[model samples]
Target: MTDSRRSSISSIKSDVKSDIESPELPLDQKHFGNTLDQKAQAQSKEQPSEETPSTIPNGGLVAWLQVLSGFMCFMSAWGMVNGFGVFQDFYSSTLIPDVSNSDISWIGSIQAFLLCSATVFAGPIYDHGHPRLLVMFGSVLVVFGMMMTSLCSEYWQLMLAQGLCVGFGAGCLFLPSIAIIPSYFTTKKAVAMGIAASGSSFGGVIFPIIFRRLEPRIGFGWATRAIGFISLTSLLIPCFCIKARAFPKTRRKLLDFAAFKEPAYALFSLASFVGFVGLYVPFFYISTYAKDVSGLEDTLSFYMLPIMSAGSIAGRIIPGLVADKVGALNVLGVCNLCASILGFCWIAIHHTAGGLIVWALLYGALSGAFVSLQPTTVASIT
Candidate 1:
């Protein structure tokens, strides 16, 4: 099946290349062919086009603006997810204290699942041209989800509001951000992506502090509303600024399994799936772990998130710079290895505050590094 798929993709690429090189076509077709040829020649002179791909745009003002838009989109969408620790703690203790950790875990797991899985369809949609509508719809869904979540009390209600609705909204918003970046940066792609991806870290830093402060005075409902307001603001900036530059007018199939034909991409995608499986387990469980194992005070357990977020800030920024220099795959490999080791270390720290703190710092750092580098790794493989 894999070989047949590869052959199909290769045949498609060859046909496209032949069409671009053909001479008996119309004037417009000939002009497009010439443009494609120049692009191919330029790609060959510098690096492997297969590795870099044509989706990347050379850096420019509009390109950087798109990156800025992507940053805002990421910050709002993923930042909310990062801030889940706050929500998890609140809900588990106040509304659903009797709920088992494993059961409550599904709320976050579903959110993360939807957020990641949404990309499968969202990518092709962006390629088809309607990023503006997709983002607008996403923003509306997210705001609505938060507003509705404020009124819910049951487990299913929370899951519907926080897990599925917010997750679906985030998926809609975030897919465009990831897919659109490749449209904007070719040479400075890594650096540009690094800067944009920092939005999540920035959100990590800001949302926790904001939610922590609000939870005391406003209560969970209003605290969430406050966070929702922040998300609203971040999402709006991108809706106005981001755009596709000379995008192709081609139709996109809903599913493009052809992407898996690339062995490197397939491997990286598999690794990504493995890495994400363990990823949210820590994010969701860390606070409970702190409270349960370390016997830490509630306030201290809460503070662990900010500490993790703090390390993540550094983790997101530095590895991005390094990925640009060394190579994204190498950085991702190391980050995953570090995360696996840290997970084991976390398992051992079942009864100590210091050990929990150490785990938080290590896991936080690795998480940032992993997220930041993954895009670059995808860029490298594609």
Candidate 2:
């Protein structure tokens, strides 16, 4: 069945040029033939006179602006998700002291889970060419959710506000930021995404510091609202900058259940899903865990999140640069193994300040690539 399906790719000798110039892809006869969209694009490039010239600019002033817009979008959405540790640690000690760690952890869990899973639905809508609307509605939901969060006093209230509202809002915004880039660039995809994905680490580093400073001066409610104001500004860029093609030549179905038929895609998707089960554990708990084990004052413990994020800034950018030269999957697979090793190390070293600090930095640096390269990994496969 696979050989029959791929008979056409073997006849297309022109693809060898791309294969030679680009980083190597994992081999399979059916995939080498190319997926439907890739085959269509290859044919167009091969026979431009018979088809319309592609208006999807690869790299230009406009393309770079979209990259900047995507960066800001990621900074606010995933950045806020990373900063959840500060809020989780604070709410447990001050706002909802009666709640169990497991219970408080769910707020961050739900937010992370929703933000990651949202791609399933959002991917199709972007294909439909409503990029601006998605960005606008997502902006509203994100800002409003943060504003509402300032007034919550109970666990359920916080969950609905931050976990449900903010999570979904971030999901809505996050998917578009990711989706719009491919509409603009191909050869530069790895670098463009790397720069945008770096925003999460930037946000992670900055927001924790923001919370640590403002929490005391303005109090908790206003401190959150202050973050909301920052998100409002960040969310605006993508709304105006990122755009869809004026005339979409093909429309894909919203969901492709048949994807389960392919072994590589199925297994990779499953691995990506399972990776998340443990993915955000440290991001959610590390700061509080550091305080409890090390007996540090509030001033010192909060810096741990920022430190982890600082290391992540390097992790996201450097691997992306290397992936373009080598292969994204090659980098992604190695990064995931390193991240898993760091996860095990998390279990043993909670007793000392230096140990906790060192572990957070190492783990953050390794894990950042895991977070950034997920989409690029899937892109390589399918």
Candidate 3:
């Protein structure tokens, strides 16, 4: 009649059926079998499908705190990488002045490359229930890398410290930061991820400004150490606050070679590769371009990357809200197209400081949307 009564009756029927089908036994053994059945039923209720409404908190203090922790991860990891433009400018003109721009660019390139490539290993590790371990280890590497970069005076040293060390450390942080959000909130995944991803934009803006203002006064080494100290402080938040929810029984593999056989996976991978190749070109060289072509003052030239990064903060947030309604994949596609068009438009902005600023802001917004939506889209299809 009532719900509880019906459940009890159904459970009883399930036990009786099980006992009848199972091998005949004494009364004590039958009672033990029924107890085991009840325990199994309880376990099943506790571990419901991810899509089940009761399983996902969707909104709560704990869930939102996870978002905050993820935000910190984005800031310390990708944020530092995003600010490599400042380093690029410094390395080309001041630090190792003899190195060609192409050679100097490799430091940032390797850093970015490792940030993505390390995920192949990090993802499987995270799924194996070592999130806190990964975050802690990554935090150490990032702070350590920045500290090492501060002491470096040569190209090879810079590459090892800033490029390999920081990049690999960030790769460790990036996967767990993005992957854990889906476990807490299914309905709000896009918005939550957007908020978390905006940390990089904030980091992007803050790191460049810190470097720009402090580098001249304190010198590059101390300025970089200050950045490292800031990263250490910010990373502590994620290290403590993030709580990894246990996923369903599906096991994660280090590499799913069969994933490439699917058209969607193959196409998405290709698109991401192409998008990234063009994306950082503007971010890395915008300051140098402004100085050489528009003859802007060094102070004004250095601010270009910060301006672009500042613009991305909004782009990172607004698109997620939109994607929650329209779809992450659709929003990502549109943003990619817009970003590409703006990349071509860079050729025409060499004449005016005002033009370059406007272009940077617009491009930042579109590219930010693309970056924020990328993981959300992948989570959806997978």
- For candidate 3, write residues 191-277 as lDDT tens digits: 999999999999999999998899889999999999999989988988898788774466567785777888887888888988788
Q: Output the worst ten-in-a-row residue range by lDDT, candidate 2.
A: 46-55
Of the two candidates 1 and 2, the one with more favorable lDDT, higher being better, is: 2
Alpha carbon lDDT of residue 108, candidate 2? 83
Model 1 stretches with alpha carbons more than 4 Å out: 1-60, 246-250, 350-352
Task: TM-score for candidate 2, please give it.
Answer: 0.83
lDDT of each structure? Answer: 0.79, 0.82, 0.89
Clashing residue pairs for model 3 = none
Q: Relative to the unseen true structure, what is the C-alpha lDDT of residue 189 in candidate 3, on a scale of 0 to 100?
A: 89
Best-fitting candidate, scored by lDDT = 3
Query: Which of candidates 2 and 3 reaches a greater lDDT?
Result: 3
TM-score of each: 0.82, 0.83, 0.88
- Clashing pairs in model 1, backbone N/Cα/C closer than 3 A: none
- Give the better candidate number (2 or 3) by TM-score: 3
lDDT of 1 by residue, 1-382 (tens): 6999999999999998988896367889889989999999985654423424465557767788888898888787777777677778777888788887678878878888898898788777776678898899889888888888888888999899989999998899887776677666665666677677777767766887887898789887888788788888878988898786544445558887887999989988888888788786766666766787778998888888877866776777777778777887888788888888887777687787887787788788888877777777887778
Residue-level error in angstroms, candidate 1, position 191: 2.6
Residue 267 in candidate 3, Cα distance off native in Å? 1.2
Task: Rank the models by lDDT, top first.
Answer: 3, 2, 1
